[model samples]
Target chain A: MTDKPATPRRRGAARTEELLQVTLDLAVEVGYAGLSIEAVARRAGVGKHTIYRRWSSMAELLLDALSRAWTSDLDYRDTGDVRADLREQFLRSAPALSSPPIGPVYRAVIAEAQSDAALRATLHERFLVTVEQRTLERITLAQSTGELVDGVDLEFAAEVLCGTLYYRALLTDRPIDEAAVDGLLEMFMAAYGAAG
Target chain B: MTDKPATPRRRGAARTEELLQVTLDLAVEVGYAGLSIEAVARRAGVGKHTIYRRWSSMAELLLDALSRAWTSDLDYRDTGDVRADLREQFLRSAPALSSPPIGPVYRAVIAEAQSDAALRATLHERFLVTVEQRTLERITLAQSTGELVDGVDLEFAAEVLCGTLYYRALLTDRPIDEAAVDGLLEMFMAAYGAAG
Candidate 1:
């Protein structure tokens, strides 16, 4: 490990990852309300001035940290069947949402979004738009392949599936197990019908 | 209007309604964070003892007041068609939810529920259970009557539809208008299909 010296670019990326990890850890322990620039700096063992230089405010820092944490790419594999692709996505992602760190962070962000207009706006622009747009695009692929009907509303279907998942996670505090993934997919297929 | 004397039961109910109305108005004016039992009593022109007698705490008072404002009960009219019936129910409730007063109150309650176990328990018992059960029952009726498939997941579908409308109302501050209701229903019908 001591054989080679690291480049500045590699060092910068490493430092960024460290800051994000600290942010996530602190967010879990004390929640969004307890989060602040000073605390994040102290937690990361970095100066408050450095944190401010990287991000304008705590909200900005937290948003960046969260956006980076999410596996930023959608896995819209054309399983040759549209419904099957959606089922795969849900199965993969639902568990992450149900897990400890992600679940708590998601809930805290949602609670904060209720009252924080600026945070809500950033949430819509960064997190929500990507999910909604990607889901629609995947649904559109199904429609073009004649897997779905000509006039089906993809946005509405996407929202029903994704929005329902978020609602259940926040509202019920129940774990989204394999059974729920199966049931949700089945219901979606039942409503949308199977691809030929 | 002043010609007839009010009956005892009618008079009691009227006074209760007046108290709830005043509470709602104060909530709108001050907000959840600023609301106080004394303020509510003063605004309602009722004794503080009377307010405390009716509700054990501020959370209970808020719940009762908001409950009075909700008109979520469905008519369950046999339209002889499940799709039409579902669409009508979804559309009929959308505008009221999209209204400024109702939407904010919903957000306030949900935010309060996160930290207050008492509020959480009451919300689940009073609101969530009723929503889930009634929607499931309605969908079950459709399934039995051959309007939907027997394998359709009633619980998931009910949650999906309600959750979608609710997420839109609470998060976006956008109107869940007739168009959105139509979009949601179209997707639901497409997924459920015409078979029983």
Candidate 2:
């Protein structure tokens, strides 16, 4: 009886992931505004209720799609050295950051987030807050490890660094390159190096 | 008689500037998709033919508007010093850059540029290419004055600095503060500072 129940539960979980994949593909193809669960269900060959069971609204579905699409969830290593760890983390995320699918999705969601209150709330809850908190944690770790200098305001540094990267992604038509990444890391390191 | 005639031309140009301001305000309020010449005419209380006589198309009108809105036309100054001039230039533009109206218009145009080929062409021709050219000229002035460090690539530096600022406008929820302005200036100067 236990084995029978476990097998069906495993299958249901797998089906949910499959449905999510289909939803993301639709989002990437048509954009956030164009996305509909009906289209997703049709594409996924799943039922409308199946989608509704998991996500109550389109914004929730889109947010889930976005969170799933965030491919850069690497370990935030202390490594007893801030600069080296940052460089590694940035470099590791570079390929994912530059991927074609991710770029358009990110751009669309960001634009949509500006207009949609629910999306804005979901974005803050699921992505933005987590990103800010995690980054602050890493900076704190660096401060504790003496990797960053004394009196270095971790919050400001986090904003500056992430702000620079996100700015590159949104404003300029150029692709985020290796040298630019290296330069950002070096510049921040140099600025905060004296803080410790 | 000719000198008197020139005064009317100047007055006409001033009226055209006012018309463009109305255009930008409309563009920000109703986005590019919803923006129409008829709506602009209604808002400006200018006759439709008046706008049509001056500009052939919506694209042309937008180009004229953008050109008029670019109030900062600073020529690159060579004072045999890069850091000081850069600081001055950046600080001077900070207020203009931080203006609430300009950012929303810039984003609305950018979003429109993504899917509209004609809009993209106008954006590049009227704004981006010219900005890039002028920025290069400024960086060249820095190089010539012997203030910019050797081996600092002019175009990349310009992109990094300008792109970072634009990105800040595009993404961050916070208002543009003096610290960010100073931090950006510091980053650019540090990256390009020559050993004295």
Candidate 3:
């Protein structure tokens, strides 16, 4: 059989995936502060222009790497019990955030965002907002079904629920384990649970 | 009047104060990522050895600067009400965190800490631990007084209380405003408030 030549589109897609994987590996090894286009290019054996052509800045490139490597489902499962669903989701995704390529890289990005306004907005728009919105959707649905108390500000509740996890994960040495998750959900349910 | 010659102790103390002030100013201007002993020396017109003499590393120097500039009272006032005290404290100290100098510098250090184990430990030991402890003390007292619900984990409570503010401050663009504080306290009270 004759070998078929790869089309330009296929080649471009393959190259993009390779570059993203390289970016993730470098991020895990050296962190975001140590990462630069030159370092990635050297590691990938590609010209600096090859990276710049694909990404306008290091933040963009790193974010793409994060997006590609993020295998956890951001959407919450509708398990009928809102608290159980949130607990399941938190437990499922906590490892990705607490360890490895994702945890360290995410921390670097958040840290960088402290100094970079443009990056902060992008992170908010892309990642945090999605999580917050999903939490809100789940909680709002529960409220509508009379599973939660009416007249309470569900938005604030959503922020606290999501905010507490990020707080434990990023700010302190405290583990976001079952105990922590239960403590949060207990407070949440107490505050928002329907009057029985 | 003839000028008195300064004692070496006084001179040394004054020089230390000046260096700290310079460090704070530069931290506000360039942030933690841009800060270095060399840069501080250049800005203050002192040799690098001067900074090295006082602080072993940039993290040490920055932490000292933070300690010096941290004028906000970390201790909660025993105003006979746990919720009110927390609200007052959060409101009183929110500006120091959300505004320049302390806010920006602290965020930079936190970002740096993600990859730096030593800095993270120092931060947790020197700053976060103190805040969490004080919070625990106040809440524990409230529980004893029957102001808060008994049997709840106050340590976890303390973490969430402090963590949520930091989450809004560092991780998201959400304003740590009166509304945010009130909402947090509301959930806290609902969950932990003594039942009538």
Candidate 4:
């Protein structure tokens, strides 16, 4: 009994992964809003009910795809200097949101999530909150070390930093290069920190 | 000859507006990427040739729709204070980007444009550049009169400002309220203005 159950469970998990991979492919090739479970099944050569059994709806399936797109090891290394630390973390994560598999998925969700509260909840819960918390930690460290200014709203600052990145990545075709990142940090530091 | 041409010209113009209106409606209801020329023609009750005759592609149709979504008369009143002038301009344009007819359409295009070059081009050309130019004009006015720092990169500063709004309007469902606008202006003034 245990052998039979385990083998099928493994097969199911493999199929789920395939479905997700195909979902990301379609999201990049077609678009987030343009493709559906039917389309995904058609592409992946699976029955539509396969996705429905695992995920509640198309949005949930996409959310699952997006959440898996990033490495959960997004822990920022704590350098002695706050600016360098933040920049390092940014460099690490930038590619995930800008590349084909993940970036397009993220862009699709952000585009759809704007109007759909459920999708936004999924984004905030599964993804964005972690980034926000990390930034807050960095800001707090900077404040204690006399890098950041006193009395700045740490939450708002973190939100703005993430918002600015999302603004560039999803909204504009502007290149989010090192120079642009430096400029963003400059504005952020000037507004939130005092130069030592 | 002029009179004969004018009748069909007026009819063509009216039909074009109707098509744009229908495009916006579909964009808001069905979203940007998913809806096609066939869909638009179906909703607008016209032959597919009608759309093909005027616009080469669905991207071009959505571009035409987005282009007309804004009130071209978004003139900022020349208030003596730069902050006040900028704030007033934000107030004027906030509604169009936040509500239905235009807001959803803008959101849909922004979401879809992330992966499509032609759509991004249309967006950059029609919407973003105008906002950037206006913000640059404000920043320059403030700089020449000694309100802002002398060496600030006027273009970048403008881009950041517009980026922040697009961040809020498209990425997050955060209320782009008066208080939020005030905070953005505060950051802009502090970073760019000569407060030291």
Model 4 over residues B1-196: C-alpha lDDT tens digits?
A: 6556557889899999999989888887886667899999999999999999998888778867876777463556666678898888887788888677777767667666765766777777767777788778877988888888887576877777777777766645576789777878877777777775
Docking class of 1: acceptable
What docking tier does model 2 reach? incorrect
Give the worst 10-residue stretch by lDDT in candidate 3 chain B.
Answer: B66-75
Deviating ranges (above 4 Å) for candidate 1: A1-5, A45-57, A67-99, A129-155, A173-180, B1-11, B45-57, B72-98, B128-155, B172-179, B193-196
Better of 3 and 4 by TM-score: 3
Better of 2 and 4 by lDDT: 4
lDDT minimum window of 10 residues, candidate 2 chain B: B167-176
Off by over 4 Å in 4: A1-73, B1-56, B72-74
For A114-192, candidate 4 gives per-residue lDDT tens digits of 6676777667655677677878887888888888888767776776777777666665677677877778777777777
Clashing residue pairs in candidate 4, if any? A149-A193
Evaluated on CA atoms against the true complex, candidate 3 attains a DockQ of 0.53
Instruction: List, residue by residue over A87-173, the lDDT tens digit for candidate 2.
Output: 777666645544657656666666665544456566656655555676778878877767767664567566566655665555445
Per-residue lDDT of A33 in model 1: 88
Candidate 4: C-alpha lDDT: 0.76
lDDT of each: 0.72, 0.67, 0.84, 0.76
User: Candidate 1 — what's its lDDT?
Assistant: 0.72
Q: Native contact fraction of candidate 2?
A: 0.13
Model 1 clashing residue pairs (backbone): A190-B191, A191-B190, A191-B191, A191-B192, A192-B191, B149-B196
Q: Candidate 3: misplaced stretches above 4 Å? A: A1-65, B1-61
List model 3 lDDT by residue over A71-172, tens digit each: 455668887899899999888887787678688788889878987877876777667777788889999999988899888888888888888898777766
